[model samples]
Target: MAIDSDYTVNSGVTTGVIGMQDPLYLAPGDISGLNPVASPFNDKHYLKWSRAVKMALISMNKVGFITGKYPKPAEIAATYQDWIKADYNVMCWILHSMIPEISESLLYVQSSKQLWDEIKDRYNQANAPFLYQLRKDVMHTIQENNQSVVNYFGKLTSV
Candidate 1:
């Protein structure tokens, strides 16, 4: 089998084979919404919105930009700066779609990971109410008569 030039395999023997690439373009459809969470601080839809945003980033080959794991400057070519800038812009766009309070605080954040971590640390809480809600949801959930098995399973796991 031949590896595609557009895709590069990750290094490190124990890391296994993971392909990496830069997206040809970033499309609106790639992201499920123009704005994911209407009110991130409210802690209501953070889980769903975060998952959607993550999917969008993954599909765009930009997850590493947010995770602080991609395109190490020392390993990249001279054009690395351009790649960083592009990734940063995409990250900022995603952040701006979150909540005004959170987005405004990201003005001085230089890296995607910094912005990502801040939002995550602030809102990714697993407190008592959150746990109770999850338990309640799991207990009350029933496979609707018209719901597919796959959809039912997905709903169950999401909680």
Candidate 2:
């Protein structure tokens, strides 16, 4: 099931919308001009908006509404950075957890050890395990796993 399907949910059907708790940045009401608690996300709405947003997100390749590199007020950043970080952290943790499974499933497993070693070689003195660097390392690991992902990104953003 592709998740974009016509079957009823959780009824042994092959497909339906992706289920809840996606932790999307845009809540249901954010798009429909309603309070976050009033519509879409609301039970009265039966999570219709939530499901719709999930479909939207699945179809939306790149969200343009977000400012790519815009400066933001500290208070605003502080208010929401935790949510973003936590959401991202959980997602990363899940993907990282699946690394071994995916590697086993595929014939060739692109190892992150080489990529990490190269990075460590580049910055010999900065060997401290830092959060920011760890994030980069994770990204490197993911890119190593999916050569096509790296190729696509590099293709689109060539220097």
Candidate 3:
């Protein structure tokens, strides 16, 4: 029996037909050793690092891997191995974007989605104390006569 353009297995999984240009497509030239971002994540700049990584992944068409859109296929599926390869490549890109200590701690994470979720969970906490301190600093900030308006605003926002 021939499969249709979109096929569904008895397991209730619908597999879409992917082409060579699909984001899920793992090209021969896609390497795992390259770091997409210029700076490694140092744990302090979670917001900045995450935005940079997201842009890089978006350019490479691999953002879906972390967002859990391109999930792994069943082991018996024809595209299972291809999905695994792409996932591994994405995982490497994420690891390479982090400092050695942070990456090493996450080395055992099984999938890119899991790794991404873990990192988000750890660094995305809301610190009331830190926020209060920043608010206080902003309130107390005074523009010195020597400081330019641009520099004064920059300092306030940088906090």
List model 2 lDDT by residue over 26-139, tens digit each: 334333222222222221222343344334434432121121211222443322452343233322322232234432342232222232233234333433455466566555
Worst-scoring 10-residue span by lDDT in model 2: 61-70
Per-residue lDDT over 1-159 for candidate 3, one digit per residue giving the tens place of the 0 to 100 score: 121323345577756566655666656776797787889998876887888889988888889889988777779776676678888999999999999999999999999999999999999777898678878999999999999999999988777
Candidate 3 lDDT score relative to the true structure: 0.82
Quote model 2's TM-score.
0.17
Candidate 3 lands at a TM-score of: 0.73
| Ranking according to TM-score, highest score first | 3, 1, 2
Tell me the TM-score of each prediction against the true structure: 0.61, 0.17, 0.73
**Ten contiguous residues minimizing lDDT sum, candidate 3:** 1-10
Off by over 4 Å in 2: 1-90, 93-98, 101-159
Count of backbone collisions in candidate 3 = 0
TM-score of 1: 0.61
Instruction: Give the candidates in order of lDDT, highest first.
Output: 3, 1, 2
Error of 2 at 71 (Å): 9.0
Whole-model lDDT, model 2: 0.33
